[model samples]
Target chain A: MSNGVDNNRRHFLTVATSVVGGIGVAAMAAPFLASLRPSARARLAGAPVEVDVSKMDEGERITLSWRGRPIHVVRRGEDAIERLGEIRDRLRDPDSDSSDQPEYAKNEYRSLKPEYLVMVAVCTHLGCSPSFHPDPADPAMGSDWPGGYFCACHGSRFDLAGRVYRGVPAPTNMDIPPHRFVDDNTLIVGEDAEVA
Target chain B: MQNKSNQGGGTVGDWINDRLPYRQFVEDQLTGYYAPKNFNFWYFFGSLALLVLVIQIVTGIFLTMSYKPSADGAFASVEYIMRDVEWGWLIRYMHSTGASMFFLVVYLHMFRGLMYGSYKKPRELLWIFGMLIYVVLMAEAFFGYLLPWGQMSYWGAQVIISLFSVLPGIGEPLAIWIRGDYLISDVTLNRFFALHVVALPLVLIGLIFFHLVALRQTGSNNPDGIEIKENKGPDGKPVDGIPFHPYYTVKDIVGVGVFLALFFAIVFFAPTFLDLFLKPANFIPADPLQTPEYVPPVWYFTPFYAILAAIPDQVGGVIAMGLAILVLFAMPWIDRHPVKSIRYRSFLYKALLMSFAFGFIVLGYLGLKPATTLYNELALRFTEFYFMFFIISWVYSEPRSRNYYYGAFAIVVALIAVIDLVRDMAGISWIALLVMIAVTAFFLLLPAHTRLNESKPVPERLTS
Candidate 1:
C-alpha cells in the first residue's frame, strides 16, 4: 500500500477538520463553563446569610453559610442532653468553660437555644471536623465514652455535649458563639440578632 | 540482516554509530500506510470519539481558570460564569453538554468495535487498553460532575463515594480520605480539582495515545475479517481500506456538525441541567445530614443500575455490581467465533446476538426508574442472563459451521450449563429444564437455512 498523496491529503483534512471541530467544541463548551462562576463570587463575598428555620423541628438541624464557614444548627439529642454534668467534669474548662466563649452563650448546653446547638463543625485540632459518632463504643473514640463527636483527625473526642475528651489534641470544648434569637424560629449569623 | 556496527544501535540509532541507526528501523514500520478499500462511513466514529476527548480536555482547562473548588464558592462561581463573565455561559454549557456528547460518541465507537470483533485475539491488548480508558473516563466524569457541588454533583458523589462503605476494614476511612474530610468539604474539592485539572487528565491523555497506537498497530479490524494490508490495489492502498485523510475528514464532519447543534440547545436553554424530571433540589448545594429520596446515578451507568437495584440489599449485592464492570473486561476472551460478523454464523448464534442486544437496552431502562420489589427484582436476575446469554450464544455458535447441529447443541449446552444453578436458586430445577427444552425445541422446529436466507452484510464504510 502506498500513500504518496496520503500525508498531503491527511494534512489538508486534519487542518480543515480540526479547525471546524475545534471551533464547534469551543462554541459548545462556552456557556457550560460560563455557568460556574456566579456561585464562586457569591461564596467569596462571604456574605452574612440569614436562616429561615421556621420549618425545623425539635430534632432537625439547619445549615447556613457565614463567611464561607459552615454553621451547623443541630437540635441536641437526649444522650448528649443527659450527660451534661459528666461532660463538664472531664472538659478542660467546664461550667461556661473559658474566657474564649461569650457569657450569654455559656450555659450547660453552651448554645443560644438549649435544643439547638449552632457551632462550626471544624475540629479545633488541625482543622478536620470531628465526625458525628452519635453512637457509643465507637471503637474509634473508645468504650464507656458515650457517643459525641470523634475527630477522625488525630483521635480527638468530644463528649455528647461538645466537651473535649481529656488528653486529646483539642484543648477546649467546641466553641459556642454569641448569638440571639431574631424571632420565633429565624436566626442570623455574624450579627447579634437580639439587639438588631 | 545482522550489521555488526549497527547491532549496538540504541532506540535513537546513535548508539550504533559504527554501522547503522535505530530511527530508520522505527520510521520504516510507520511508512507507506494504506487504508482498506471497502471502508466507508462506519470508520468515522472511531475518529469522532477521539475528537470528543480532545474537546473535553481543552474546554475543561478553560473552565478551571475560574472554577474555585470549594463548596462555598463552587455553586456561586457557576452562576458568575453565567451572569458575570463575558460569554462565560457558552463555555460552561459546552463543558456540561460536552460530557453527554462524549458518551454518545464513545457508545457508538464501542458498538462498532463489538460488531467487527475488534476485541479479538491479536487486538486483545488494544481492547483492554481502550476499556481501561473507558473506566478512567467514567471516574473522571463522575468526579468532574461533583465539583459543581450542586445537588446532583453533591448527592451523586455522595452516593458513589459511599459505595466504598460496602467494603470492610478501610471502608469508613477510605470514604473519609476520598471526601478529604468527614464529608465532602473544601479539602476534597480542592484535591479533586488538582486531579481533574492536572493528574487524571494527564493520565487520560497518555492512555488515549496508547489506545491509538495499539489500534493502528493492529490495524482497524475490518467487517469481512480479512487483513487487507497485503492486498493493496494499483493505488498502493489496501483494497478494503481508505486513507484517513480526505475521505474520513469530509465524512465525519456531518456527525460533528449535528452534535454541536444539539449541544448549543442545552447550553443556551437548560443551563441548570435541571428539567421537570431532573428536579431543582439538585441546584441547591448538598447537605450532609439529609439524604435525598430516590437518588439516581448519572444516566450512562443506568444499565448496571438496574442490576444493582434488583439484588437483595446486602454487601454481596454491591460486590455483584462491581463484578458487573469487571465482567465487561472479559468480553474479548468470551467471544470465540471464528468469524467476525454473525453474518456467516449458524441460526443459534444469530438468536444469541439478538438476546444480548435486547437485554442491554432493557437493563439500561431499568436503571432509570425506582427499584421495584415485583418486576425489578426478577429483572435483576435477567441482568445475569444479559451476560450469560452472550457467553452461551458464543460457546454454542462457534466450532459448528453447519446449521442443524449448531442449533441443537446450543439448547443441549444451555440445559446442561444452567440446570443445577437454577434449581439451587429456586428449589425447582425441573421448571428450569422445561423452559430450556421449550426454547431449544422452538428453535429446532424452524428450518435449518433460516439465518442464511435473511442475513445482511455489514453496512458500507465512509458514507458521505
Candidate 2:
C-alpha cells in the first residue's frame, strides 16, 4: 500500500469496528436486561393458591392473595345471580368476550361455577381493587344499581358477574384468574382446571 | 477585584489555577456573568429550587442510612427512623417538605418563564433542559414515594404503572418490566429504591448543570424581555446588566433566609401540611389485597390526574395525561408571538394565560375529590380549557388571527354545552350550560367591542 491515506479501507474499517462494538455492547446489555425480569423466587411465589369457601354465606366475599394480586371469591345469592342477567345489556362486556379468562370460565358467570365468583379483584383500568356492593339497590350506588363491584379510584362499576359497565374508565370486565373448584367448596387459583 | 488579586497571587492558588480553570469558571459563571438588573420577586424561585434540591439530596443520603428498601421491611424501617433514630424525624420531615417545596418553587419558576417568555428563540435548548429536569424530578419523586411502602404508595404505584398497559401490544410487557414482577412487589421496591436514591438524582443533577450552562450561554431573560446585550457600554458589558455574584448572590441569600424560615416553620410545625404532603392513607402499611377507599396522587400530580379522570375512556385518559406533561416541553414552539413578555402581549393572551392558570388550579382541586359526576363534568370543562390555552396561544399570537381565536373559543364552549346536555339533563346541568354560554359570550363580545387585540410597543431597555 502507498504511504498516502487509503480512504475506502479506512472507512470500511471504521464501519466494521462500529458494527462490532455495537453488537458487543448489545450482547453485554442482554444479561443486565434479563436480570430485570421476574426472578425464580418471584415466579415460585406466584404458585397456585388454594382458598376454602365452605363457610362463606350468600352475599359474603373474601379476598385472597395470589401472585401479589387480590383475588375475590364472592358467594353469590340467587337474587344477585338473577340481577346479573338483568344488567347484561348495560355491561360493556357481559358475555366476557374481549376479556381475560380460561375457556371453561368464559360463559355468562365468568367463573367455573356460577354460584362462587372467583376472579381477580383488580380493576382493569388502573388496578385498584373494586369494592363489592352486592345489594341490588345499594342506595349509595344509586337507583339503577344492580349488585356488583364499584371502584372508588375512578368510579368504574361492574355487574354481579364482574362485568364492566358501559361509560366507565375500566375498558374490560374484571379479570378472571385461571381458577377451578377442587371440591365442593375449595377453589384453586393461578392453575387451570385441566392441571387438576 | 481585591479578593481575586489576593487569592490569585498565592502559590497554591496559582498551582491549582494552572491545573484547572477554577478562577476562570467562577468569573465566567458568577462574578463576570452579566444578568438582567430588573429581576423581580418571581426571580427568586430558580435559586430556591437549587436550594431545595440540595436539601433533598443531603437529607436523602442521611435517611437511606437507616431506611430499608424491601417490601417487607421498608414500612417498618421508616417508622424506626421516625421513632428510634436520633433527629431522624426532623431529617425526614425536611426531605418530605423539601420535595413539595421543590415543586412549589419549580412551578413558580416555570410561571415566571411563561410570563417573561424565557423559552423563546436562543433559550429553547435551555428551556428543554429545564423541562427534562422537571421530568426527572417527577420520576425521582415517584420512586421515592414508593419507599414508604404505604397503602397509598402501593395503590398509587399500581395505578401509575398500569397507565403504561393501556397501549396495545407492548403495554402489559412494559409494565411488567417496570415492576420487575407481575405486581408491585419486593423486586419493584428494590429497583425503585435504586432509581430514586441513585439513578434519578444523578440524572437530575446532570440535567440541572446543563440547564444552568444553557442559561449562561444566552444570559437570563428578565421581566421586560429586552436583550441587554444589544446595548453594551465602553467596557463591552451590557448597560442594563449587573454582575450576578455581588448583585444576585446577595439578593438570593436574603431570599434563602426568608425561604428557610418558612420551610423550617413547616418542617417543625406542620410537616404533613394537613395530609397534603404526607397523605393519611400513607400512614398505614401497604396491603396487597386491599386498596384504600380513595387513591388520589399527591397534590403536585393531581392537576394531570384530574385531566385523566375527565376522559371517560381508559386509553384516552392515559394518553391525555401523558400529553398534558409532554405538551409543556413544546411551549418553546407553541406560542409563536414575537412579544417576549406578557407586558407587551395583547389583552387576549393575558386573559388566556390567567384562564389557563385558574383552570389548572380548578383541575387540581377536582382531582383531590372523588370522581363524582359533578366533579368529573367540571374537570372535563377545565381540561378542555387547559389544552385550549396552548392552541389559543398559537392561534392568537398575531393580531390577524383574532377571528380564529373567537371561532375556536366558541366551538369549544358549544362542545362543552352539548357534552353537559348529553351527560345530564338535570336543572343544575342546564344552569351550568347557561352560565358557560353567558361567560363565553361576554368574553367574546367584549373583545369584539374593544381593542383587546392591540399590543403595546416593546421598550428598548429593561425597566425596573
Candidate 3:
C-alpha cells in the first residue's frame, strides 16, 4: 500500500504544480496592489490651491479648498488677538511644542503673523471640522469661553490660533499647513515659497 | 490484504477515496468524531458562528464585484449597489447584518467557554487561537468599515488610526506609512480595501483552521466540566460521548434553523432596525472637512470604545482600551479556580459574571452617547468594575465560611442603607427592599443548598 508505483513522477508533478500555483497567486495579487495606489486624478487634485482673502472683511473667516481639505484663514480682530494672550495658559501646548506646524508659525499665535491666522480647519482629535466661534459670548461653550474653534464631534476645543485646550480629547494642536502670503491680501496653501 | 479489499467500497467511491481520502476526512471530522450528549443550548453558538462566517464571505465576494474603493466613487457606488444592482440591497444588508451576527454568536460562544472553563490547561492553545481570530475579526471589521467611504467610516478610521500616533518617536511616521498619505484619503481607503478583502480574511481563515484543529485534538469540554475522555468504554470511545454526525449534526441543524429564522428576520424585514448595526451618518460621503455631530462606533465595538473615551488622556485611554481586550487573553491564568463549571463554583463567581455582563452592556450604551459628565462618570465606574470582575475572581476564588459570607452581606446592607438614607428621608424603596431580601436569601439559604448540591457528587454515568 505504501508503494505509489511511480515516486519520481509524483514528486516532479507535485513540485511543478506547487510552483505554478504559487506563481499564479503572485500574478493575481499584482492588480489588487496596483489598485491600492492613489489614482492620477486624485494625485493631481492634491496639488496646492490658491485663495483670495482680499474681499474677506476683518474679524471674518473664509474656508478655502486645498487637496480636498478645508484650509481656514482668519483675519483676527484686535480683540481676538489680544484675548489670545489670556487663553495661553489653558492651551495644552501653548508654545506649539507637540503640534504639527511649519517652523515659521511656531510663535505663540501659531501663525505666520499675529494679525492673520492660517491653519487647517480639521480637528486633530478625530478629523472633525470645528465651527468658528469668533464671539466670546458663544453660548454653547459656556461662561468664560474665549473666541476660538469648537469641535462638536468629540468636544475638542481650540483657541483662535488653533491651539488645542488642555485636557481635551485632541492630543495636539490642529495642523497648520505649509502656507505663505503671495501679496498683501493673497495667500497660497499646501506649499511654501521654496516648494512652489 | 483484507484492508485493501475493505477500502474498495465501490468503483466511484474507491476512485475518489484513493486520491483525496475524502471519506476518511468526513468520517474523522463528523461521523466518527465524538461529542458529549449533555451539550446544552449554549453549545449551539459554535456552529452558528461558522454559519455566519460563511454567509459573510459569500456576501462579501458578491459585494466586491460591484463595490468601488476610491473615495470619490465609493459612496456613489454603494448607493448604486443599493439602487441599481440586482437584489444588491439584500446582499449588502445580509453582509452588514452578518457582520453583527458574527460578533453576536462569537460573544455567546466565548461566554459558553467562560462558563465551562474551556480555556483550562490542555486547551490553552485553542483559546489563544480563538482570541487571535477575534482580534483579526476586529481588524477585518474595522478595515471593511472604511471601504464605504462614508462620514462615520472616515471619522472612525481617523480616530482609530490616530491612536497609533500616541507612541513616542516613530508614531507619527508609522501612522503616515499606514495611511499611505497625509490623512485618511483615497490611498487609505484603497489599502483598507486590500486588507479587508484579502489580507485579514486570509489570516482569519488560517486562525479558524488552527482553532478547529486544536479543539478536535483536545476534544470538547462539557457542562459537567470534567474530562469525558477519562471514562472510556470497552470500544475505546468515551462512554459519555456519541458520534458527532447523526447526533450533533442533526441537533446543529435545529440550531441552524432557529438562527436562520432570526437572521433572515433581520436581513429581510428589519435590516435597519434600531440603527445600531448600520448608522445613518454613514449614508453621507466622507467629508474630511466636516465631521458628524457624534462619532460613536458600532454596537459591537462600543464597550471598548467606551473605555477609550472614558479616559481623558490619549495615551492612557489607548492603553486602557487595549488592556480591556487583551485581558481576555489572560483568562486561563486569571481564573485559577480548580472547578471548571459555574455550577460547581460559589455564587460569588456567578454574581461576578452577571455584573461583568451588565457592565459591558451599560458601557456599550454609554459609548453611543456624546461624552458628557454623567455618562463619562458612569463609563469610568463600569470600566473599573469590569476589570475588578477579572481581578477579584482570580485572587479570591477560594471558598469561604458562613461568617465571611455574613460579614460581606452586612457590609453591603450597611452601604445600601447609607446610600438610601442619603437619598431621601422616606423609607427604603421597594426595589431596594427586594434586592436586600434577595441578597439575604441567597446568602442565608442558597449557600447551604449549593454546598449540598456540590457534595451530592458527580454521577457515575451519563444521564442526559
Candidate 4:
C-alpha cells in the first residue's frame, strides 16, 4: 500500500473535504441560531407608549411599561427640584455624563424639562426596579436619606433626578428614556423630542 | 472477533447474544470490571449521582407533558400540574428536589475526588469530563428555572442575563442575543424551554457517557489512592480488587435505597426543602416591571453568587464569578504533589483542604442572604480564602523548594494587602488585616510545620 502512494493528493483531498464540511455545518447552523433572536412580533411590540401626565401632582410618580421596562414619570415638586442640585456632590454621575439618556435629557436633572423626570426605573446594578421614595428624610430610608429611589434587591439608591449615589452597587445614574411632552397633558415615551 | 457459542446450547438468548455483543458488553463493563476493594462511604456519591440523573430525566420528561413554555401560561401551567394532573405534583416535586439533590450528590462526588486525588495523572480526563457535566448541568438548571415564569425566576434570569452585558464592546448585543428580546419574554422562555428539555440534556447525557468511559479507562480511584492493578495475583486479577457487578453493585444498591428514602421524604413532605430548593417568591407569577424584594439564584449557585456580590464593580464581579467556576477545571494541573490522597498528605495540605471546603460553605450561605455590609465583607474574605487554596497548594507541592514557597507566600500576602488597601483607602478593615496576617504567617511557616508533622509514607498495598 505504501508503494507509490499519492500522499500530497490525499492530503489536498482531506483539507478540501474538511473545509467544505465546515462551511456546510456553519451554513446549516445560521438560520437555527438566528431563530433564537427576537422575532418580528417582539420587535414590533417595542412601540412608543403615551401617558396622561396632567393629573400627576407634585412628588407623584407613575410607572408605565415601555419596551418591557418600567418607565417612571415623576412630577417633581419645587423642593425636589431644588434637592437635586443640593445632592449633586453626593451623586456618582451628577451631570449624567456616563448615564444613558437622550442628547436633550443629558443635564443635571436628567430630563428634557426640569420638573418632570422621565427615567427607566430599573437599577443599573442588576436590572431590578427601584421603588420611588420622593419624600426627604423618610424614616425607613434613614435620617440623612435625601429623597430618592431605593432598590430593595441590592440596596442601590438613585436621587430624585435619577442620579445614582456614590458607594452603591449601581454603576451609573438611572437611565433616562427618550421622551417628550406632546402637550401639557400628554407625554410620549420611546420617541425623542427632537425626533418628534 | 468471532462469535463464541453460549454455554446454554443455542437458546433464544444465545441467538441474540451471538448477533449483538450485549452479553460481552455487560461482562466487560460490569461483571469482569475490577474496582478497588477499599472504596469507602465517599464512593457512594458517584453512583448516587447517576441515580439522581436518571430520576431527573424521567421526572423532567413527565414535566414537559403538562408544562407550558410561554411567558403568560407557564406559571399557571405549573399550578395546574400541582393541582389537576394525576401524580404531576409528585413528579414535579421529585424533579425540583432532584435538581437540588443532583448538585448535592455531584458536589460530594467532586469532594470525594479531591480527598482521594482522583483528578491526578491518568484520571485527569475523567475529572475533566465530570467538570464538563457540572457546567452543562448548571446551564440545564438555569434554563429550567425560567420555565416556572415566577417573579424570582424572571428577575433571577434578568440579573444573570444582564451579567453578559457587563462586558466592554459586544456586551449589550450579546445580552440581547441571549434573551432573544429586550427582556425575559416569551421568546426567551421558549428558547430556554428548548435548551432545558432538548439541547442541554442531550449534551449532558453525551458527557456522562464520556465521563463513564474515561472512568473505565483509568479504572476507579479508591480511598487508599493506590493502584490496584499494580498487584495482580496468579489468576491475573488485582489481589486487592473486586468485580464491580456482585460486589460494588450490591453496595451501590444499598446507597440508592438510603438516598431514595431521603429523596422521597423531601418529595412527599418538604418538597421545597425549607424554601432552599424553591423560593417562596417563585409561587407568584412573573412581573417584568416589578422585581421581587429579594432576587437570588437557587442555593446550589449561592457560593459563586456570593463571590460575584463580594466584588463591588460590575465587570469585576462578573469576571470573578466566571473565574471561580473556571478555576476548578485547572485542579488537575494545580496540585503537583507526589501524594495522591489526604491520608498520606502533609497536615498543611489537609488543613488547607478543610479551610477551602469551609470557605465554600460559608460563601454559599452568604450568597443566599442579602448583601449587607458585614455579609459582603465576610464574603470577600472567604472568596480570598477560596482562591488562596490553589496558590497555597502549588506553593507547598514540593517540600524541596522551601525558599521558593516562602517567596511565593510573601508575594501572595503582599498582593492581598495591597488589593485590600487600594479597594478601601478611606478605612482599612481590621478583620481583613488580621486575616491577611494569619494567612501570611501560616503559609510562611508551612515548611517548619511539615517538617515537624511529616506526611505518612504511602504503602504498596491498599489498607482495608
Please give the ranking of all candidate structures by TM-score, highest first, separated by commas: 4, 2, 3, 1
Candidate 4 lDDT over B1-464, as tens digits, reads: 44455555577878897779799999989999999999899999989988998998999999999999988789999999999999989999999999999999999999999998999988889999999999999999999998999988999999989888888999888888999998889999999999999999899999999999998888998887898988999999899999999999999999999999999999999998889999999999999888787887899999999998887677777888999999899998998787899999877778889889999999999999886778878888888888888888776667656667667777888877876866622366887778776876685566754573257899999989
List where candidate 2 sits over 4 angstroms from the true fold. A1-3, A194-196, B1-10, B401-449
Worst 10-residue lDDT window, candidate 1 chain B: B419-428
Error in Å for residue B14 of model 2:
2.6
Candidate 1: stretches off by over 4 Å: A1-196, B1-32, B233-237, B269-279, B400-464
Error of 2 at A129 (Å): 0.6
TM-score of each model, in listed order:
0.61, 0.94, 0.82, 0.96
Label model 4 with its docking quality class.
Answer: medium
Better of 3 and 4 by TM-score: 4
Interface RMSD of 1: 15.1
lDDT of each: 0.63, 0.87, 0.81, 0.87
Ten-residue stretch with the least lDDT total in model 4 chain B:
B1-10
Write the residue-wise lDDT of candidate 2 on B105-215 in tens digits: 999999999988999987999999999998888889899999999999999999999999899999999998899899999899999999999989889889999999899
- Residues A1-196, candidate 3: write the lDDT tens digits: 2665687888899999999999999999998756544556545767777788888777799888776678899998888888888987787899889888998888878777787898888887656688888888988777998889888655678999999987667878998999888888778887764532
A best-first ranking of the candidates according to their lDDT comes to 2, 4, 3, 1
User: How does model 1 score by TM-score?
Assistant: 0.61
TM-score of 4: 0.96
